[model samples]
Target: MKDHVKKILDELLARFDCLRGCEKEIVTAYQLMEECYTHGGKVLICGNGGSQADADHIVGELMKGFLLKRPVSREYATQLGRDFEDGAYLAANLQGALPAISLGNHNALLTAFSNDVAPDMGFAQQVFGYGKKGDVLIGLTTSGNSGNVVNAAKIAKSLGVSVVSITGAGGGKIAALSDSAIQLPATETYLVQELTLPVYHALCAMIETHFFACS
Candidate 1:
């Protein structure tokens, strides 16, 4: 990791002392995410209820500027201006992005699949559709055992997509299914969710610094 990226992670650990022992797994998750984005692969995230919101939150931070402005590269900006009349304007207005998708955000697909086929399999189906080799799937469940998220992880693995699970202590089944399992020290749902926020925020900051920081 770059010094700046590692700094963000260090700050996370300092702020949340409870995350002390999870250092290795947190770094491992960051590595997986960094590798996935570096290889031109997107991320697929899934969860349930509050965890679902967290998944969307992660996508929000990733797909646009989080801590940095992330302006387009000069080469792309120049090409944009040359290719179209408003290309320069468009380029100036757009932000650099890390591609990501929240599986639970597709209400249409989720509801239809849940009603027609299997409720727990909705996320799994989306994983099968969006996941490809080199992609990464992140599943968040307070208990580490949301059936749908677990199923999604399973499918992600079959498709050769790496899996990262963020959950409370013990990490349940999803943790076992993951390539990197970040089990927060807290076990209660709310406490676990609280810890989750900072961890992911730090992850986003680390990744953004790695790819978009001004050197």
Candidate 2:
């Protein structure tokens, strides 16, 4: 049992160590999130397969309190009095309401766009419709070579949205397309995806602590 626990801890520590190389990019992404919150801009995240799951997971963490406590807003305090439950506090405070959308959803629209236009245009189409200037678009690709994610970054750039990409260390097309590229040191797709999960969770926790703690 002791050996098993130590092995797991060592693996986790190693995974975190992989992030040291991309620490600057991670900080840049945090800054982008802070900017978006300050300016009332939204964040849009998209990816494929495991990357898609990562996108949704990051959004989920951002849409709710991670570690800090978010209080009820004055408006809600007045309406609900002082004894409202945690759910009411969240509803009143408008906690986790920072307008983030995962483009990986909406399969109907995605399939239609892929069928009519090009498959690679599915995510890009969504970005064209939903993205705006000053918004943040985060694209995740293990290999950094997904055409859809790359084109979405291109569209995001054309539309003046700040683009952040999380990809493997080889630096695929997404690295060139994005404004800030966070490259993981791992080469294998599964390892890259595994490393990406905590990187995004850390960013989400940082954003929450930085912007939404006081409500």
Candidate 3:
């Protein structure tokens, strides 16, 4: 693990010591994500309500620069030059991205599923369509048991995908289904979300730093 990543975890512990017990799980999540991305696997995230927002936020950070300036590679720059008039401009501005998809953000598909088929399986349907072996599904639910997120995780697992569940105190049903579960010490939904933000941000930074900082 990178020092700064560990540093972020330590700082979070300092601010909320009750989360001290979750350190090991958090590290495991980081390691899994690193291996996934290193091997060209993408991440699929799902949640509800505020957690949905969190999912979108994570995708935003991962699909572009978060803590580092992830300039496009020279190879890509050259390829773009041969294809378009504004190739140099496009290449210069484009950033290397870690592929990610927020399963909660598609309104059309979600509404269609809810209206025509099983409402709780919207995320699961997306997972079935997009997930592959070696990819990861990050499910966020303060109660550790959001139905849709849980279903998506279950489907993901069935397809040989790994699951990382982020939740509050009990590490509920979703935790049991997850390969890595980060159960923070808080019962209130808002409080759990507050803690989740920093944790994922640290993860994004760690990954970004790993590839982009030295480049």
Tell me the TM-score of each prediction against the true structure.
0.96, 0.85, 0.95
Candidate 3 structure quality by residue, lDDT tens digits, 105-194: 899999999999999999999999999898999999999888999999999999998999999998889998988999988989999999
Q: Ten residues in a row with the worst lDDT in model 3?
A: 1-10
Better of 1 and 2 by lDDT: 1
**C-alpha lDDT values of all predictions:** 0.92, 0.81, 0.90
Query: Stretches of candidate 3 above 4 Å error?
Result: 1-4
Cand. 3 TM to true fold: 0.95
- For model 1, residues 150-215, the per-residue Cα lDDT tens digits are 999999999999999999999999987999999999899999999999999998998898899882
C-alpha RMSD by candidate, in order? 1.2, 6.5, 1.4
- Which of the two candidates, 2 or 3, achieves a greater lDDT against the reference? 3
Model 2 superposed RMSD (Cα): 6.5
lDDT of 3 at 103: 91
lDDT of 3 at 47: 95
Q: In lDDT terms, how accurate is model 1?
A: 0.92
Task: Mark the regions of model 2 whose C-alpha exceeds 4 Å error after superposition.
Answer: 1-15, 79-94
